[model samples]
Target chain A: MIRADETESTIVPRIEVGERLEAGFEWFEDTFDSAINWVGSTVAYISDGLAEILAIPDALILTVILAAIAWLVRNWKLALGTVGLMLFIITVDQWNEALETLALVAVAAAIALIIAIPLGVLAAKSQIASRIIRPVMDLMQTMPALVWLIPALAMFSLGMTAGIFATLIFALPPGVRFTELAIRQVDAEVVEAGHAFGSTPAQILFRVQLPLAAKTIMAGVNQVIMLALSMAVFAGFVGAGGLGTEVVRAISQLNLALGFDAGLSVVMLAIYLDRVTAGIGGGEGVLAKLLRRRKSAPVQTEETAEDKAATGSPTT
Target chain B: MTDTASNNVAPAVSVQNAYKAFGRRPQTIVKRLKEGATRDELKSQGMAAVIDASFDVAPGEIFVVMGLSGSGKSTLIRTLNGIQPPTDGTVKIFGQDITNVSPRQLRSIRREKIAMVFQHFALMPHRTVGQNAAYALEVRGISRSDREKKAEEALNMVGLAGYGGSFPHELSGGMRQRVGLARALAAETDLMLMDEAFSALDPLIRKEMQDQLLELQQQLGKTIVFITHDLNEAMRLGNRIAMMRDGRIVQIGTTEQILNDPANDYVAQFIQEVDRTRVLTAGEIMEPPVAVLGAGQGPRAAHRLMREHQTSALCVVDQTRHLQGVVYEDDVAAAVAAGAEGLTGLLRQMPATLPGTLLAELIGAASQHAAGLAVVDDHGRLHGVIPRVTLLNALADTSAEGAVRTILEEAPA
Candidate 1:
């Protein structure tokens, strides 16, 4: 069997005909090289420095953390499952590393949401704006995610910033596209209803359209979070850290156990977030149903309360 | 919202030659556009949904617009509230031309002075009942406290009290409709426009809502522009009814005038479906008694009364001048079987109609009440019989010339 060094040689492409032609491939080389340097620096900085996260919306932040615990482990059986999973991950002694991985994911998702929502609302409002923006959204959506990191590294230099930049691009399309589509799906009757109430376009957008489209928008958020998390792990190739780093690190050392544990942790986090998001999305569904029934709830409430609590996303 | 904008010369509400259209084909509108079609012209070629229509709505009156489906009733009503704009005309509310009002001004107008109720009840699915009801108030910047109070009051008014926290999906169709009405009522607007609002409800529920609307109207005296196709509903609710067809008003008049005296064939035919007897009251048709007959007289004796008075049937009365059974010729025959006194068996009589009863119901009740003849009334007492001939003659006098009594009364073959 080939040694680790020999494997690296096989994976890396060989030099071609001339320096100029080589330079023709220079973009890739430069991108990778910078990405390596960027990751190295970010690791160096994070190892020795603190990562500063801007203030989390207190309501959403606490709610999310509480939701993670409640949704996955609210019951004793679920609690045991979660505890077992956590012990398995920590026993591999990648807990600190997993925390770093989670941070990167959280950052990417937050950035994607920040960028996508405004763009979605803008697309919903103006045909001209949509015309200018839609083609770019198409490109972002169609292009493979890894391909973006090359440019991201070229532009931002290889580090947490570049890694996040790449992850953002990868996760962004779903949220923005879904948001625009969902907003468009808002009932024309609803729009008319808002108008009848004397709602201005701005008011209708904020009060009527967005809230009505909440579940759809939240679904978009789910896709974005999942995609960002997936992309963040892959980004470790450019020296972006987290469970992905451990995967690559273990692969480098030919340590299958470490690689397996890291991959397992990522899957766990993914499952947790997916459940929470899905739960919240389901919660909004309940909210909509409950809203419809509010008039008669006085008579029927005993029958519906349990359903509401189960489906209601206190976190959302 | 600029609802606070002053209008010194506003004419309440006015529509001038308004037209609304949609393209039958995409290219048609584009072709028109190329052919120098302006916004109005471009819009006109499309579906011409509402056509060159003009009407004025006075303040504090219930004005009903009646039409069959696709007759521009909904479109016209929607345009009044600024949800849809007219293609080639002006809509002025309280003197300001809203045809080109900025979205801000339009919102303000809708917020402060105009409210609309939709047939589907378009309540926001995401909001709780209180939240939905208070939506407009919030849009207009009302504080939470005041808005909640107003929403509560509105919900109570619509019979949705204590349901402020529930979501729409939890409500039934009727409850949802009430929530919608509550939402509009919460807006505190002066002008209320409804588009087939009660049509989606069941018959009994619809009747209840209609009664509620009347009560609300009576209490508030708000100016209302209501759209409906059911002639009965229009008659019941409208102070004035505008009959529309193919995008134009065919006729407009008071319920009494429209029912008793239709303006044209279209209006008359429209009236034909209505229970005309219900529309006209005894007070309106009452004139001096044309003839008199004794109590318990039969239609057989009505020949003398008809000949004496030269009238079809005598208005029968009892001893105390109260209405009693009509003394008609048929009653006379009946009395003969009962051993009538002398040559005239007039004591066995009956008249068509009772006091204070809807004459429209009389025909159907006639058989149940048993007697081809009818009884009239002075008050609650039995009047006299309108004999088969006299009744036919009276109807003949009132019916239009050559307008045969359409065997409108028939079970389908």
Candidate 2:
């Protein structure tokens, strides 16, 4: 008997999926040449501007500012850790490159969120939209991340613009998926209550659904930022400058020291962004606790004074 | 029973042959239902939540839709507010047809004419109790200060005055439901829909909430459609209750009528465990006074009337039937022996109750006197009398069959 694999290969005609994809890419480039060029130049300008702004502050002062934010949002331990990691990057002369990577990741993630959130909301509200979007999102996520660079390179050529475009696509699915999940997970009775009170669809979305889904949506935002950071490093393969360039160069040349230093800098940056974003998402950061205490302080004092007055004497 | 067409005054809510089915093809299911298909026969096609329900709620009347889970009472209430428009038939609120209205008009009608209290409290977790209470008014585009003022007043009405600043998570379950009630009340709508509003609370809290709702109803006089699975709650709060089973309304009647004359086995079975003593009123069981003595009648006449009626005592009343006092036969005989002229000398004070007093409360008063309790109107006119034996029979007639038999055997023609 013939083997099952051999029989399958002989019976089915091989489809030229790879060739079709290449032709599709070429057609898109030819059709949207001007639009692609405009987007590329705009993204490049914004990334360059952000890099220059991030570079203006002295490295030490910038590190201090970041550490201070970590302390306020997180804790002293995280702040100290951030200071150590950032200082090591500065010592290794990777601070400027790290800032550039930061700029690239920031721009890509912001744009991804701007597109994904509304799509997610639409998907959550309408069954047809959800059905259509879910399969597309699945395809986007499951497709090899590197495959996106091929079309991105053809459309924008080489540079940070191409890097950002690839990174944007790579980071998009989670934002959409998580947002849809968050909104859909809101209690049905709560939504019914909104409708019962005569709230319009828009009002219910903004006032009831969004507020209740805030923490979950913020978790989606954290995932987007993390994905953007990882993809920005991958974008370095297509001439996107920053720590990614160093990493690519070190990898090609097989220089162990350069590779190790660049890789560590990327790790430090990822940890900082992840922790800060997680604190914002989880809602029990040190700063929040302090603020809540401060808000309740006056009420406690007023209550005590009222109690004394009500008892026919003001002891204090 | 429905006065939608017959009455000159428009009902607060009028539902006509409303049918709601849940599935991809609700219309097909509704059509099948109309063609005489039973709910079980069409079960695979769609779940018929409500089938051909029709009712009219008069203004200021508490119309209760009561059923067990999966009986479509909740679905029926939703049709009134246009939250879930029925698959077939029309719904009107104060004479305006809502079934065919646009979304904007439906929302406007909800904002202007209707407010709703939910089962699970449904208070927003992110908002403070005050903000939750103000939600309905905020949706109506009321000014912040005005809505806040109204919300505070509503909270005060629900006895949650100082808890407004607290978040819903900080409040107890009962308090959260109070905030839910305050939210509906602050809307100031003429019509309110409550879907099992007290079902989630503890027994004690549920009873308190029910009493508060009744008190609020007395003050506000809002037309309310209350949905509940608990028959006792329906009897306690509803002016008229519609009993539902398997997506169909089985019967609609007052508590007395339903208890004495159930339309079907389902309603009888449904109300099997209802505490009849709590549900029935003294007026329902009271009989016309056997032999009423005029205040101008002498003690001898009272004694003679008591003997003629075979009663131990006679109620002395004015010419206009205003209850003066009860004259016992022994006292009348004593007065007669002492040569007293008027019943005034022999008349003794008797406990009087309003017609609406529940028999549970009258049992104690009924037990205290040989003459039993007097059922009186607001102006102290004697409507009827509940003798001790009648009170005991009414209390013992807890089962629906026994109640019907007792009413038939004992009720005067």
Candidate 3:
């Protein structure tokens, strides 16, 4: 067999992008030490504050408050279901870890929304900004959840703060994408009507576009919550304490019952959080319809574009 | 123009050489970098929607811009309130040049001076009818109580009372349009732009709405710029109608002038299918009666008046020119020959027509009566006469001269 020439069959060309990134990161760490320190401390302060508040509350008391909120925001059935899930976590002896995870997810998602929504609005306002952001978001969403922990650990130091920072990056794309979509989906005619009546640009955005897009933005918020929950367990490897750490401990000791109970508690908590958020998001739509019924209802059950056309618009 | 000036009031709206092009405006730097880019070269890059449209609308006048789709009529109307700014030229509303105003000033103008009623109503789906009507007032930062009171008053004005609590989705098509009208009324702007505002309703309802608008115009005296593709509607509502074609105003004149003297073949073709009866008022088609024989005039004078007016009959009127009856040429000649000084025997009974009577309603009376119909105003004063030939020509869709000659020959004239 003839040997291929050295230049001919090199399967892939070597690119020094990874090496450049590593060198850049090293340079950043050396030069931006004070900035990094400030950010890391801020993250620590917020995460610690949240964790302390969550941990101080008695499990039963916290559960009752959460259940009450669910009942008020949604309905009684969702409230009872939440109570059951909280009791299950307490019985499994994982209530403390569950609360810790809840604090981490809450802080992460809140930061993500605060940052993401405005960024999405900016992106939606400008095509060039949107073009630049879309690819970066795709990369963030597609990268393995664990891959983010490496940089996050280096930047913030390994702790719950680092875990939240990682979760924030992981969950941010959905919030941004949905917010941009919601703003763009507001009817152009409605916006024009607002302008025709002499509404300022800010007024149009706040009074018209924001209200019309509320349901869609809520859906985005729900997505962020779900993503944060999913990332919490993966964050445990970097010393982020939660049910994730408990599962990791069980795995190392090969204690089957402890791992099973811990995993079951995570599942219960995830299910409960998901249902409550979904109810809050979706229940308003049904409730609004029910309220409309008490007043004079539309001729059609659904006011579709076709139905509007059927009424014979003057534009015809 | 001088008549309006003498009254010390400017036209409600004045547009001068307004041109609008649709497409990305070429970058200024790009144009500078390129050598010798001609107007044609630049124009090729963008579609021109309006071309040098100029008109003046007097105060309290319903000026209509009439055209089919793609004729730039809608674009021209939108340019009035700075919704779509003209590429070149000026639009002044009550003598204030809106084109050069800052955004803040434009907003003030929109809020305080101009109101628009859309074809689709453009009512806010989430708001109650009253709230939708008050939207313009709310934007102007009026107090809520005042806005609500004004909105209710407007709804009542448009005959949409008791609909304040209902949403747009819950209302019928006609009611929704009424709400749209009420919204504009609530704005209380002196200038209103109605873009195909009544075209959406059923035919019967559309007629009713048109009548309502005319009634409102009498009460409010708003200077309205009405847009429509329907020539009949343009004829009915417009104090002066502007005909647009391919982004240019082909002609602007009164309904009678447009119907009798079309500017070109395009305008002629546009008005061809329009039902003349529906469009022509009796006042428009009526002519000076063959003769108005005063009650004091003898049969000889009646015969002389008939000959002078080139008619075979004469109308007998009182001293106030109020129409009493008509006398045929033969009867007048016979009365004169029989030496009868009193004209009672010469007077013939005939149907009387009103100045507001449509040419359609006068056609039958004109064709059946030998002496034709007398056109009178509400006070019974003789406005003019609608003879058989004149009524026939108005009703006919053929060439005007040919129709009159054919009718005159076909009749006993």
Worst 10 residues of 2 chain B by lDDT: B397-406
Which residues of candidate 2, in runs, are more than 4 Å off? A1-8, A75-77, A285-316, B1-8, B288-298, B304-310, B316-325, B342-349, B354-356, B376-384, B398-413
Best-first order by lDDT: 2, 3, 1
Error of 1 at A142 (Å): 1.9
lDDT of each: 0.70, 0.86, 0.81
RMSD of each: 10.1, 5.5, 6.9
Per-residue lDDT for A185-249 in model 2, tens only? 99999999998888999999999998888789989999999999998888889998999899999
Q: Is candidate 1 or candidate 2 better by lDDT?
A: 2
Listed per model in order, the count of residue pairs whose N, CA or C atoms clash below 3 Å is: 57, 0, 0
DockQ of 2: 0.33
Give the Å shift of residue B164 in candidate 1: 3.0
lDDT of 1 by residue, B1-413 (tens): 11111323344678887776666664455445446555455554565566667777776667889999978888888778777777667888867788898778877788888888888888888777778888888888897777777887797798876677677888888888899888888888888898898989998898789879988987987778889998888877776788888666777777767766677777778777776554443333334454666555545455666677665335566577565543444555465577655434343344355433444655554444333444444455543443344333333324466666457677577
Local distance difference test, candidate 2: 0.86
Docking class of 2: acceptable
Residue B123's lDDT within candidate 1 is: 88
Estimate TM-scores for all models.
0.71, 0.91, 0.82
- Rank the models by TM-score, top first: 2, 3, 1
Write out fnat for all predictions, comma-separated: 0.52, 0.40, 0.24
**What DockQ does each candidate score versus the true complex, computed on alpha carbons?**
0.29, 0.33, 0.21
